[model samples]
Target: MGDTGESQIKSGQGYPVLKPVGDSAICIEFGDEINDRVNDLVYSAADALNARSPSWLRELVPTYRSLLVHYDALAADYDEVRSDLLGLAASDSAAETSSSGGARQVFELPTVYGGEFGPDLDAVASHAGLDSEDVVRIHSSIAYRVYMIGFAPGFPYLGGMDQSIATPRLATPRTRVPAGSVGIAESQTGVYPAASPGGWQLIGQTPVQLFDAQAQPPSVLQPGHFVKFVPVDESEFQRIQAEVANGQYRVAHSEFAS
Candidate 1:
């Protein structure tokens, strides 16, 4: 669809700022804070934009509250592209605060908490005035929303963490955090996805490969997905790891309309 197409989506709350990024890109800021409602709008806008992308539209990157769109400066004029995007931002369907185009999948991820895998678990618990088991119980109880997939390949920036067990990041960044490590920083908790240097407080580890370069889409999770942690023992962790390596393990997920 071109910029002249009728807007089918309803308008959302707040005004979107269309800011230019350097020479070849634009960043559409939806809001400031990290929230589900705002992200839904971003997701919808991205879905709608990509669906009816102009020839100048190069790449669309959706984040917590903005959509970074890169255009071909050589093939298209920036002002024309800007006007087209402005038209999209003004569209009712794009303005609608919904992720209609994105498919949301609920994942039940198996994780092993404490001991060597979760070195900072006890320390974090002690700081929170609670035991390690209480920390695990509380952490695993909530179904976290995947706000965005960034940092490492499939590393999720998850929201909906329990306020009770909230903890800050490590003062000193670790040289290397192993892949599959689950960590919490302030009000957020997320998996490591891959081994990398990180500062988030480590709490657990998962055997599931969050990102597989050889896989069709690579990343296992997406922005609209909800992740549920299923605590598993060390033995089960080992078994799952082996199964995954042998390509016999299936990651359990369910599809439901949001």
Candidate 2:
């Protein structure tokens, strides 16, 4: 009757707060800053809300630390939806709110680190006070966790990078960065889902397409997914590129116990 199930958990300072994003939408902010815990909260709430697709809820757009909840005014007014959101916020059932318990998919991205594909690799290493090899070693060593998808179709917001590799963006952005370009910014890394203007310091590029509207899941990556970058040589890059052009290359997939 009262939007039943776990509606009594204590919320931390990182609690979700609703704010008007537009006349028809409200943004539930999980954190004021960009961090993994906060992002997990955003995605958790969005995923749970989306699982049911309740009549009043129209859309759930999850971002780095916030989720945009769009509703139909005719079916449900602002107060009705806001109350429902508060119920979700207070839910205490671990089975319902735990981020780690949710579904996840893994994607393996092959990258050619340094050289023409990644013009900024050297600069990023230099900025971080590490040699090129050290940069690659640190980068390829960690499995990044996907927090959300935005900026472009299929573009994933990934977390879990080695803080030591954090490098500031270039003073100026490139006009066109090829799709599947892997790059680091501050404490995060992400793949450029398509050839587009971007400012993240690129360390490599993968031939696999990240966003294909033709596929069942347009974006190969999504929130709660895991990603890893496997380094490849230039020849391998050419081979994969050719395969992709010939429509034979498929983004490698595997199951994550997580």
Candidate 3:
């Protein structure tokens, strides 16, 4: 079914649409924008689908506004899978997962703002009409939400930056941004999962390994997780970095009743 529709429930405010991506996949769209209201439904539906998984279902990839479902082409039929998804979208079970789909994990990412790590901190501060220190205060004040992980592996796409300090992305992207680099692009801020090319204005750097190949989850952050940037002294940053590199540090994180 390549049709778009909205849920007829007040608690669930998703303007969801179901469409076929190919012969073996279906994408469930929940609004066409990136907002928490839409994210709730996306994750909730993921939980609902995972809870009662079809034998032929393969993987679920949740994005800003949609969930991509991949299935075994040999074992599954598109029409039947689409029908099952339609039934889910029209039911309250999919809507109810907004709160209980998964416990919202909170992570305290220790960052070293400014200096050699964050070369563009001063520029961002100047752009925002604030001093570098004040900029750090504003950036670290709030607990940002992990909207969706994309761009690079373990690279978290976070939201909820203070509008006052919002700065545009750099005119030309850096050829290589270090892993654990924390940057602000307009109203959103995120950590660089690896040393990759990016245009986001760099504000700080963290020692935490956002992605570890040998780690259980590989990616430290996941969608719906809450993150707070904890500013640390240069000495502390060095210490933590050493600890991390030596495999002696555990990234400080907790789970809340989200």
> lDDT by residue for model 1 over 1-258, one digit each (tens)?
111112212123345778889889989877765667667778888888878978888898899878899999987777887899888877746346445555568898999999999999998898899999999999999778887888668888898888888898999999999999999899889999888999989999999998989997888887878998989999999999999899788889987676
TM-score of 3: 0.90
**lDDT accuracy of residue 174 in candidate 3:** 97
Lowest summed lDDT across 10 adjacent residues in model 3 is found at 1-10
lDDT of 2 at 60: 84
**lDDT score, candidate 2:** 0.79
For residues 154-253, what per-residue lDDT tens digits would candidate 3 score against the true structure? 9888887889998999999999999889998988899998898999999899999889889888888888888999999999999998999899988788
Estimate the overall C-alpha local distance difference test score of candidate 3. Answer: 0.84
Can you give the TM-score per candidate against the true fold?
Answer: 0.90, 0.86, 0.90
- What is the RMSD, in Å, between candidate 1 and the native fold over all Cα? 5.8
